[model samples]
Target: MDIRFIPQAEIDKQLYNSCVHFATNGSLYGYDWYLNATAKEWDLLVEGDNYVSAMPLPRTTNWIGRTQLTQPVLVPDLAVYSVKPLSPKRIQAFWDAVPEEYRGGGLTVEPASVPKNAGRFEVTTAVGDALFLNKSYEEITDDFPSTYYEQLARAERADLLPVPALKPEAYADFWLSVHGKSVDNEWKYHAMQRLMYQVLHRSWGNAAGIQTRDGQLLAVSFNVYSHNRIFPLFRAESKAGGDAGAMTLLNDTLLRSHANRSLKIASEALYQRSR
Candidate 1:
């Protein structure tokens, strides 16, 4: 088999369609979102009689490649590999085909390694009702003030809630407030940029914004959509208010509003601590 690298945009649509079909029918979780996010950055690896494609999905400076072999092969143990509802045999076969060189590197194929599922939690409304099924927090705390939830719930009930949205222009200001106090890194900015583009392209759900009572743009969140799942890509708030809790408030409102749709909160493992 010859390994050939090509841009994702150049890959045959039929092959992509096949991957999608396999993902959906074969119980691949996050595959749809991964494919859609990295569709334009994929490289196809072909053999004499068969072909496969590798697509890279980047978050900040880190990236993970999703390999699609022509035949069902052993899946790699990448941090993002999620094949639910798929037969154990098929999943094992997929993992078996993963290149040995790719096996134990920092690269991950398992869903847990992606850092997306981190900080995911099921947060309830102040009324102690299960408002959101799964939620991700920026930090994990053993004793987060319970009052925060109550305040958030109150905010929602009063219709003073924040909506999850992505505003690219506010990226710099938001990051400075969130991470700058501790360490100044540009990774968040890059991630935000990619997220903004994804939002602009509607790669995620409809993006929206949160405002202060004074009408200040406080934060933005990316609402990622995949059939029934809705993941918030990036959620941040201004630092002007001490313990603003705008993000928490926004999440509460979103969950309450989206309860009828059964929207599941999804994220990489890195954000799971807060959940």
Candidate 2:
């Protein structure tokens, strides 16, 4: 139950990263490189010398210019990650150890992490979706309606082909040019750009897209992969391409590329939207 905060610089990256990578519920977002790219600043709360349990406290400047522990963009869960399953009380200890200044700020925990006890902190719930890639692509799609294949066929007829390796910089520029104005907040846009670059630069993941044979770019998506999971993080599509079912084709390629790998797609909403 002994938990203490370690400043970002003072923590042992090797030990901490080892714990996260090997933990039962480890995620790419919990890794050091991920935090460096997304969080403006961060610290850690550790439960034991071997890092038996740990939580990442990502910090950022709020709209009002005050420092707060905030969730990074596109990051879903940021709670205690432990080598073994944690009891509600042990999880609560890590939450309590978070510095008071970051109290009002929020982050998310995996559903399995919460077990009916939250001593003094307020808790809110949100729903997310994931797709399990446990079977062959055909078997996985067998449950889908025939219209889904029709959509992909339309994209193929339109001459849209999958670009399995899209340059990160190109994807970022494409995303910003398309969705930047809609963001309304400049900081969020820049933060997203930084995250995309760092993640791709480190080769932690890759960006893929659908484009015409004549080389007209249409739809693009960024996916981060670990040993057993893939996170379909950000995506943008041109109006014409979307109408031609470019997104559907892009997602189909993604599914086919990693089919039968037993990987999990963190956000299945992307696939659902394409349909």
Candidate 3:
């Protein structure tokens, strides 16, 4: 049960590999490329000699000089990633392993991973639900309500074609135009949008979109690919797109198209939830 801490500044291939192997969603968000690209340093928790179990500690400081730990974007909640669910006692040990300095700090944890008898840490409801794609296209299409079905049908008739090879700038620019005013006017938000587009150029994922027959862009999404899962990051649609049901068509098409492959699309709550 030996535990070692690796500062975010010193993370390397070895540590990143360990993270990818041990973390549940490692393949998507636990790689050096992702960590470096995001430019947000995250400390690592390694167990035993080779990182048998681990978790990331994403760190940041506020303008008021108060340092806080927060979850990175486009990632599900962090977990004490391990070979199996940690027992109540081990979960407590994991919590204790956090540098005493961070013990009192707030961090996000997967609700399921937090043992019932663990610590007295506060747990808040997650802001969003993630859609884990497991069902087939036929299954998905059949289940969607009439509203979605009607949207898809109209979007197609509107002559808005799917742009599977959508460009990154197109997606970023569109989002900024529509939603940037609502967010912090900081450079970081803008920079992250650029970085997301840059990453889209890689084989890891793609920038998907939909456009009218006249080539007017209506919607775009940057889907990050890793470990056979596709997370469509920042999917957005224009007024025209919304009216035409461009998103409904795009998403439904993806689900059906990738049904043969082992690929699954994880969304931030596209369907209903029980928890």
Candidate 4:
């Protein structure tokens, strides 16, 4: 029950990372490498000597030059992951461990680890769809609308193909080319590219895309494989690709390949909630 804030330099990475690696509610977002790529600076909040419960506190200096605790870009929310479902008191203790200056920052707890009551915490629930890949491909596809099949057929007719493990640089450039206007700042643009390279080069995740017969890129996604789940970091589809159903085809191909694996694809709703 002893909870303390450990600065980044002071953290015992071996113990802290092991806790995050094995936590039932873990995700790539909690990993040190991930925080290193996205956070301006960060530290840990650990529950005990064994590091049974933990959270990563990411910090940043705002545009006005004020330091603030914040979540990383492209990350929807974070959690106080633990060995077991923590009681409200334990959860509160973790919150109480936050340095007073960082108190106002918010974090979202994993659905599995959240308690029924949160003492003194303003708890709110955000729900999103997840594609559960427990069933056979056919069984899962049976629930899809007829239009999905039609899109797949269109993609097929257009000779668009799903290509796994897309090259990082190519995909990043394409992503920025297609969506750069939407990204308002140079920092965010660089952060997105840095995250893509880190996730792909480190083998923590992969980039998949759809391409034409001539290998022209059309649609792409960066999927982080962690916590026994697939979370998309960035996804985009060109108009030509969308019209040809390249994105739909790419998604179906991914689902089919992983069908019956008991994995979940974190939905677009989940990934884009913070955006």
Best by lDDT: 2
Question: What's model 4's TM-score?
Answer: 0.86
Q: 1-275 in candidate 1: lDDT tens per residue?
A: 23344354565655543443344322122243344433323233322222232223322112465333221111122221222333444333333334432323233343322332212211111111112343343222224566766656544554443544435656545655665653324645554565456556755555555666666665556665654556565556656422455556655555556654544544331122122
Per-candidate TM equals 0.55, 0.86, 0.81, 0.86
Q: What's the true lDDT of residue 84 in model 1?
A: 36
lDDT against true structure, model 1:
0.41
Candidates sorted on TM-score, descending? 2, 4, 3, 1
TM-score of 1: 0.55
Which pairs of residues have clashing backbones in candidate 4? none
Candidate 3 deviant stretches above 4 angstroms: 22-27, 37-39, 62-66, 84-86, 115-136, 182-202, 267-275
Q: Per-residue lDDT of 20-39 in model 3, one digit per residue for the tens?
A: 66565444555555655553
Residue 40 shift from truth in candidate 1, angstroms: 9.8
Provide the lDDT at 218 for model 3.
82
Candidate 2 local lDDT, 66-100, one digit each (tens): 66667766566765789867777777777767787
Number of the candidate with higher lDDT, 1 or 4: 4
* Residue 126 displacement in candidate 4 (angstroms): 4.3
How far residue 93's Cα lies from its native spot in candidate 2, in Å, is 1.7
Ranking by lDDT: 2, 4, 3, 1
The C-alpha RMSD in Å for every predicted model, in order, reads: 10.2, 2.8, 3.7, 3.5
Q: Tens digits of per-residue lDDT for model 4 on 1-275?
A: 78888999988888887888898767777777667767758888998888898978787766766655675776676678788666777766776677866644454545644545544444444357877889899987776777888888888899887774567667767777777556354455667678877776767778889999888889988888877788877688888888898888878878788999978876432322111
- Candidate 1 segments whose C-alpha is farther than 4 A from its true place: 1-10, 25-85, 100-103, 106-148, 153-166, 181-187, 239-242, 267-275
Q: How many Å off is the CA of 220 in candidate 1?
A: 2.9
